[model samples]
Target: MSTPTSTAAGTGQFSQRRGIRLGYQMPNFSHAASPRALFGSVIAQARAAEAAGFDAAFVMDHFYQLPGIGAATEPMLEAYTALGALATATERIQLSTLVTGNTYRNPAMLAKTVTTLDVISGGRAVLGIGAGWFELEHDAYGYEFGTFTQRFERLEEALQIIQPMLRGEHPSFEGEWYRTREALNEPRVRDDLPIMLGGGGERKTFALAARFADHLNIICNASDIPRKLDALHQRCAEIGRDPKTLETSFLVFGFIDADGDRARGLQRDLIERTEVEPQLDRHFVGDPDDVAEQIQRRVLDHGIDGVIVNMVGNGHEPGALESAGKALGPLVHRG
Candidate 1:
């Protein structure tokens, strides 16, 4: 296997090779019939995604099912553990969390965890992290739910410790939130494990992405994409970094079926069940072709680099991801 090498300053091999243009995010596991069948279904989706030409597969890093998607009691797998299992079950597709909550683990430990995953996946791990926003998980897990500024500060410090460790260096850092003394991460497969930041906070997140991220998965409303892109550019510019060096993608909620009506119906049912207004701007609801068109017009047309979609309604169905991959692979790869 080829060892990973560093790319451009803010970019990593993942984005440099455009390996995340069309990603499959598995955020719902309740589709499985039982606990024993859950992981089989997960493997099936990952295989379907890889066979259908998706470049990456992601799982949400949450202890419980997130609100608006399902009740808190729904089944939720540990992200890194799932990814480690996935690395053995699949080949060629990158594995990661859509965004790991920074508060959930110690920074150096997180670094070692991802490095081990890189070795297991033969260097196909991307550290997708953010200043974790889900307060419920924090509360339930007994992790501190700090102020917004404090969370960002912790995330920054985490990155400071993580970056060096990923490259096989012992880093000693002291911060108000976290401190590491010559922490070591060993048994690495490659030096340049890519990092992806997920969120749309133009002030803090964008600045951090400019400084630390290899890719930015912008999580915002569709209409806000252009403005967000502009803000991201400004952040990069402020750091004297070229904006193009930091690749970007959008996270979209998908309700897709071959039958467009069925897809829309699913979307409607989700709204009714959750009793929360759908952020339609962040959703793609239709058949494969229709969703592809929506993504092209709203996402790719806005200068975003890629798309990571979670098909909450029917992604686990045998051919659901295959159909989506057939339609979307060409669209994002065209970039």
Candidate 2:
């Protein structure tokens, strides 16, 4: 098997120049007034992020809304379809799902889908993927939800097939879980479309990222970052790959408002509504300055390469993402 070329410099112009230091994630669509207004709201936020200097824009790839964010019946857009439309709607910001579940599509088909997105986006597509989780979605959508080890095994095999196809090579592989015979991917805007793995499993996820992903978006709580980074470094060492070659970022659930009190209130409401313990390490709820300070202290200071914030509470409101961008852009893009 041929080693896939490095995509560290091929995510897009923004990534090559600034390396995804600041990203906006749109995780909830319920804020849209009605079904007809959904895509418009998404476009508005994407444009705002681009205008506010965000390096990338992300959406969740799920058939149903995530548990903590909203009810399952709430609006959830198909990730690739949304991204394809976003490609025409915005100009600069890179577009992708925060992490695409590998179980949702076949490896070869997934390769072709993202390659099409890359061509449509004019080289601004990123293949952010992970081993499938969310058994509820799988059950509801009729995708097989296997045991934990099985899912990881499938992911490993899928990558074996995906990596070469992403590089325009026809790879033939026969694995217990998946098989591809000289699968072809043509019409790709660039061969090295970046693949970002999102998760914080110290063993499996990190090791796979070291071997296959150009970036690793750490998705665990903030307190776990140091340990996760250490694990990721160890994984790289095990494979004789430099840890520095894998760019890293942390996921933050933010609730930003100009008024600090209002931001706190919003956070409280979410906690009350979801009836779950607030994982403070993964959340930043405050005024712009407050959120930025928390991110700098908790995320950037830990040596993570970037921050991807999902402001589900108010991100759809006018100026919400802009305010976040204004505060976070400078912190992540320092000299």
Candidate 3:
């Protein structure tokens, strides 16, 4: 457990306009290393990513390996704990889970948790979150797994508490799903710690992002980027907020290998093993050049501000981060 530093309160390190730039999401934790050695492997990856010009480093925020990623029994680290430790192991890269599930902890708990992370990391916390989506984990953890609409309702209620609390305000929120009596968050790092909302729901997600989020990680298909961005623009207009104020990025699943042929094989194996549909347009399964080209053509062409790529296959290799970065860094803006 980490404690917040009082001296850091109300002092944010970054602004929303700069955006995420380029991020590496650590999706594969299963290295050849043993359990005790696993974190060392992760540290190497994070250090490699930072050296490769990746601005942020992320891990999935799930108790179990996701259905398409790995088995439930596979080793999974509690996110904030890992991040607090990661804060010490690396410098420069922003540390956060891709998007935290809202159902796992109470709003005040989550708020205080992120605040503590910010304080520990010298103010590099990005509160990446979404309407809790993984139902199986919720059931396993005894968290309420409601219908999709119900979950969004809960998320809306949760944010009503989370947003104000992040700013060092003890909001007294009473919603159908949650009730807090002037919930207090102590030792906050900044009044404006960036809030990044993940997901691409037109009506529900964008509306909330337009209201409360500093950034929006678009999780929709590549082809849907144009339409979804347009919808985001409208959502901001509906709320009389400037869409530019809410930075945007697309979450791209990738398979980066120096050997194109071997990379293709790894891609096929990953898809087959996970039984998850490959985002053909959004995902790339080839060498670094291929990754860079696709991002420049598809992502930047559509006016997306930034791209967050998670290489689930061969990304844990020793020199993979450098190779992947060599290919993708030219197109990515570093601020």
Candidate 4:
């Protein structure tokens, strides 16, 4: 779990005004050479992200292999457990599951876990939840992987139950799938731990975010951002909410390397390791300046508030983040 190193540069026009924030995800999943080895490496990487000035650090919550990532039974770490460890290890950066599956744990239990993590981490935690996807995980865990619609319904009810509880509201929920009665959460989170809703399901998921989440994270082709933003804005209006009130974030995957040849090579190695073709059109890659430029262009062109770069490059390259931030630092100030 690497910590983010920030320079206290004001969130200026480049990022802040546009709500530009930088976050990172640990690349310690199944692509690792060894889960044990990658565990320590990921911690160091988290520290590097902090050193390089990132807003938050996240870990993926998947019990099975994502289709493109190969076999379902690969070495995947549970997000909540990983988060507990990360909370103990890092000091400054906010910790969260990039997006956790609602079906994996009971809603009330999940709320308790987030509050516990918040208390342990001194209130620097974000609860990022999503309707469970990846059927393999559900099957492997012997949890029912129902229809997409059913899963989404479950996810919404989960929010109804968990959010209020986290917010210190004694929540009582009776839904089709889940039932809770006037349950009180002890030692409520110290800070206003914002809820982040993840998923690109335009109508349902986006509306849910507008209604409840403090942050909304979307992952899709870059070209799709404008359309989604428009829809999100529309949803905000429908919900009588201001579009600007919700923080927007993107999940970007790519590599950053200084040497042109080395960068390309690293990208290639990553593509192979992850067993998915590199989607550079939507990724950040190349030399530091190039990477920074791409991020700047994307942010301005699409009105993106911030980016959560999925650091999916080769092993323990400390300079990777530092150099990228240096290149991005100047651009970080541009409106």
Candidate 5:
């Protein structure tokens, strides 16, 4: 098992690769569902996703819905709290945020929170973190929204403390953005809880992933996948780490429906509503077959480790999760 997760295992750097697996991100608490039913809707979608053969499920870690998805006032649940509840609701599917914004919490507290999640979920937690990018959230919540360089620096310090703690070791580090005095995460469920680092910063992110992360989920223009993979490989090699040991995946925006026409219609409406040009490079808009084929050709063929798709439209509706999985599950498993 590639560390049995993207977050755990070993002393220095990750040394193994988990086989490719599929995942879904439930990102629709603010759209079709009533405000009162937000968390329930999230739980239901997560349950449906697991039943439909998704290997993992995720939600965004943010105080506000992202600009393209909804307004800031849209219902956005706290990530760990929702995941803690999901632990009781699920038996097999891995649970995590697509990527946790590091600035939202203190590094030590974040490590402890993830450790608690690991214990609660029976070792089903993954630390998917990134140099937080949502400036609006930071400004809104009174977090120090620093420059890009500063955020990456903070993230590096965070991992120094977080990774060792995940492995049941206490680490002390003092840096410009953070300082830890022998901080530790106790009662760790497992020493090797996989750590996944998300984003596509070629210099900062890939290097950090090489040194600290077991998985790297690339978030970028779809046309950039191959180049990004090459860059990641180089980052691993530069640090004398094996590239294969760092599993990889891409975030796909999927607009799925019963048929192509319906899917495209939904897609067009979303485009009109958002008033933004569609980013269809790694995105899929069609029936199961269309989505699956695009995933196979664009993602797997590029040697990505996995595919994590987000059904942007109609995901909360009945039969959507199962039907989409029926088409995409085979491809995800084959990876």
Candidate 6:
């Protein structure tokens, strides 16, 4: 349950040890899952994760589902509102979005919302920020989905403005996408509210995370891990920072099954559902022991400090979650 530490630059920010931080992605786009079911399921999942010893829980922030998912305007809950409800429901696990878009809300307001949620949750909130993606959702909702470069630029600016405000200062900023006066945020509940940036952008995003984020999330081809991590180190060095200061988190799209045949079948079904080729090399699947071993191997092999086992929505049925949580006990609890 406790976060283990490792030497940073050969100096200890934490003890020289690290452990897997188990996290579950609460399904927002799951076709078989509804808002009411999601709310209840999230509550249950959090409790289950806590009892099973997960480190945190996160939800998706989107008005609609990804294109392939049959439903167009499916039931979805706003991220911060659901977070407030989640705060009231859970006791210990940290809460956050997989990554809330900078385009969705004003940076100042989003920062304030997270700080408030952190306070309500007694400092267990993580603000995961990112450049908005999924053009369909933006276009349909009447929001401009600009070029990729523009979004990243906006995301960087948002972090620069919002982090300081959350840290108790009036932030003044002017940017191409967003502008703000010297605005002060009141009742800054949690001084250490962690600002996490998600993406695999090697240039701007990774560098910005090195400079600003408490944590960095890696979401990309599993083969890209070593190269991206190397880039992260380079960025930290460029910023005159110790690379070890930032926590590394990976998002895996996979499953866990006890029976080998059943595991392969589930994986096949998942691939069919998503219409995307399943990359077993990039995923964790098989029995509890097999999955656990894969996770541990990923940690040591990929230089990953923690992992967020993306249940991939309905792909993770009841028994699957149980297997993952129970089997992962060793790696998650290891120190």
lDDT of each residue in 254-285, candidate 4, tens digit only: 57776867877866765676656656666677
**Runs in model 2 lying further than 4 Å from the true structure:** 1-18
Ranking by lDDT: 1, 2, 5, 3, 4, 6
Comparison by lDDT, 3 against 6, better one:
3
lDDT of 3 by residue, 238-300 (tens): 978877778888888888888888888887887787756666776777788987888888887
Better of 2 and 6 by lDDT: 2
Clashing pairs in 6: 5-17
Quantify how close model 4 is to the true structure by its C-alpha RMSD in Å: 8.0
TM-score for each candidate, following the candidate numbering: 0.94, 0.94, 0.92, 0.87, 0.93, 0.87
Task: Mark the regions of model 5 whose C-alpha exceeds 4 Å error after superposition.
Answer: 1-20
- Best to worst by TM-score, what's the order? 1, 2, 5, 3, 4, 6
**Backbone collision tally, model 3:** 0
Each model's lDDT comes to 0.88, 0.86, 0.81, 0.74, 0.82, 0.72
The digit string of per-residue lDDT tens for model 1 on 87-126 reads 9999999999999999999998999999999999998999
Candidate 4: stretches off by over 4 Å: 1-20, 30-36, 69-73, 273-280, 329-335
Stretches of candidate 1 exceeding 4 Å from the true structure: 1-18
lDDT of 5 by residue, 231-253 (tens): 99899898788887888999988
Report the number of the highest-lDDT candidate: 1
Q: Which wins on TM-score, candidate 5 or candidate 6?
A: 5
Q: Which scores greater on lDDT, model 1 or model 2?
A: 1
TM-score of 1: 0.94
- Candidate 4 vs. true structure, TM-score: 0.87
